[model samples]
Target: MNQQFEHDDDIEPASKSQLKRESEELQALGEKLIPLDRKQLESLNLPDKLFEALLEAKRLKAHGAIARHKQFIGKLMRQVDPAPIHALLDKLAGVSDTHNAWLHGLERQRDRLLNDPKALEALIGEHPDLDVQQLRQLIRNAQKEKASLGTPKPLPMKAYRELFKLLKQFNPEPPIPGVLRSDDDDFDADE
Candidate 1:
């Protein structure tokens, strides 16, 4: 009975030591965020052009695509970082007060665009190519193209969407204003 008890005590200590070692290994693994290899990274459902962008991030201050690529890398890092990822998942957790400030600014700009005649006039003055007459003429041309029979025609949907997207990106709304409580009916304001 004494021999059996001694053997049982030895087994318990060995098992505890093994558990501690395994726990430490897991903690070490969690701490190291390894950069995935090309084939392994490709397995992730990222945009097809992402690898190219990442390669560009290796270079400094490459304008346009490079800036965009750097932004992409930031996004990728945020995604991979357990801390940021958790904060993003939890609405109450890691909040960007700066982003909130920017949103508020955007809302103010949007209100200015809507209510201030001078601002609207300025935009029209700057982008004279986006005149209402020109818009109407383009719509008419698109309609004519669509209506034409025989051999399917390509809609200038690409050009129209690209133009509108660029305009919206350029003239983004400011974040919420203290005075302007948004209503469900106001789509542009809500946006």
Candidate 2:
């Protein structure tokens, strides 16, 4: 009976290598958090002390200091339950993907408008709120800028950019369901 009890006690815990890998994984997750803007980082709802430490890490210029701060963040991360953080990050990633798809749709619409006159009529039919005359003028200028094929002058992107802005005004992406959007979503509006 004593021997059986001793054998039960001898069942080993996770090995040192496994522990090290877990620590490294946590550190890598912390690294990913570094590049997020202030509002997005705030949305993670991190513990206040840990959040301050991360902000400090962002300000650290020296390579050694940044590395040390990252290790400290990894240590802090181990103390918190990371499931909620993971969920928020995943939700934010999905929002980013949706925003990119919307931008691509706008780009395709702009190209169609520039290439085909009938595309303008189709757009106005679909989005009656858009000003047909303004769209026509912008399309004409964009086409003229594109035609500088044999000149030494560089292509002017002003009209192309203006068309994108106008399209955004006409149709904006609907908010993602159940997700609190961060202000950083507008960071790429100009692009």
Candidate 3:
């Protein structure tokens, strides 16, 4: 009896219901994996068969086909341990860390604009919806304040803070679902 199991032979085989629950959990895990990019999937170090199956699953789109393929993934999952895979997924999804790296990137951009005149054009190119005049003013103000102070250290001036706030509003990352203050769908009226 113990010979049938890999981890522990003393433990009895799981009941049918418990087995079914595990299968469903693995299927759910596969569903999450489907949305991840190829690079992320490759980083998992999963068994080759499972990796190929996942790639196929991602390539599939038809509803019935996807349903059947997901079942196949669940079967494949049974042959593998899920703990390490799940830990990697959590790290990629920013579940384990504060995920503040994007914020730091934004700050770097802000500083770049302050230092280089050409940076404004690049920023505008990336965010076409930006109010160029307002941003130019903020940059000018921030620059003046920086030049006025003899200290080499950066200061938290009003314009510098305002620029960051404005930049934050146009963050490229999709906002978390259900985070809106109102379910208004951003309805706006034209003049």
Q: Which is the leading candidate under TM-score?
A: 2
Model 2 worst lDDT window (10 residues): 177-186
lDDT-better candidate, 1 vs 3: 3
Q: Write the per-residue lDDT of candidate 2 for residues 1-191, one digit (tens) a residue.
A: 99999998899899999999999988888877887777766766778988888888889999999999999999888876665566556555655666678888999999999998898999899898887788889998888887874679957878888998888877776554443455454444456
In the range 1-191, model 3's lDDT, one tens digit per residue, is 66667557577879999989988999888877877666666656667898899899888879999999999888888887777667556545556332245466678888999999899999899889899999999999999777767877656588987887777667643333222222232211100
Provide TM-scores for the models. 0.26, 0.63, 0.47
RMSD per prediction, one decimal? 16.6, 5.9, 13.5
lDDT (C-alpha, whole model) for all candidates:
0.43, 0.78, 0.72
The sequence of per-residue lDDT tens digits that candidate 1 reaches over residues 1-191 is 99989888777445788866755553332222123334433333334455554544555464686545554554444334234322222212224453344445655544454346575567668777666555444444534444453447754444333333335555543432221222222233222
Q: How many steric overlaps are in each model, in order?
A: 9, 0, 1
The regions of model 3 sitting more than 4 angstroms off are: 1-11, 97-191
Off-target runs (Cα >4 Å) in candidate 2 are 1-16, 43-49, 60-68, 78-100, 169-180, 183-186, 189-191
Residue 21's lDDT in candidate 3: 95
Cα deviation at 94, candidate 2, in Å, is: 14
For lDDT, the strongest prediction is 2
TM-score of model number 2? 0.63
lDDT of 3: 0.72
